[model samples]
Target: MEQIFGGGIIWTIFIGFIAGLLARALKPGNDKLSFLWTIVLGVGGALLAWFVGSTLGWYKPGEPAGFIASVVGAIVLLAIYAAMRKKK
Candidate 1:
């Protein structure tokens, strides 16, 4: 089952949670993201990492990034979100 999904959906969700938490912690200013948004942020981050990492030959498709990469991805997204919000 795990092989079917590579690392499985559960692993993605768990990594997303951890990445999101780390992102929130690292980001400056008070947190404004909701619970759902937090999850989205994390998952989005993971997706971003996968995309970038794969493009850079850091990882293969269906391969999940390590915790540090996930967190870094999350932080980048968070920064983008903040910038967009600031412009509004």
Candidate 2:
């Protein structure tokens, strides 16, 4: 778990929160996410980026995703979330 997270759980949560804020700021449009949800989004994005990067050999084992990549991943997730919400 520590290897996957690239740090201890607390560190991951801190990074995730920061990434989430950046992602929300960079993405255009309104996102009705609470504080907790933002953290979840960021963490999820980081995981997503790590998985994709690993598959593409951009990241070796136990390597954490870059900040930019994390933000990008969050943006992609946010877009998907928005699209899904729009459909409802």
Clashing pairs in 2: none
Q: How close to the true structure is residue 81 of candidate 2, measured as C-alpha lDDT?
A: 96
Clashing pairs in 1: none
Backbone clashes per model, in order?
0, 0
- For model 2, the superposed segments whose C-alpha errors exceed 4 Å read none
True-vs-predicted CA distance for residue 36, candidate 1, Å = 1.3
Query: Taking the tens digit of each residue's C-alpha lDDT, what string does model 2 give over 1-88?
Result: 4553578998888888888999999999989799999999998889889889999999998888887888889899999999999999
lDDT of 1 by residue, 1-88 (tens): 2321147678766667777988999989777887778877888877777778888998876676667776788899989888888898
- Show the lowest summed lDDT stretch of 10 residues, model 1: 1-10
lDDT (Cα) of model 1: 0.76
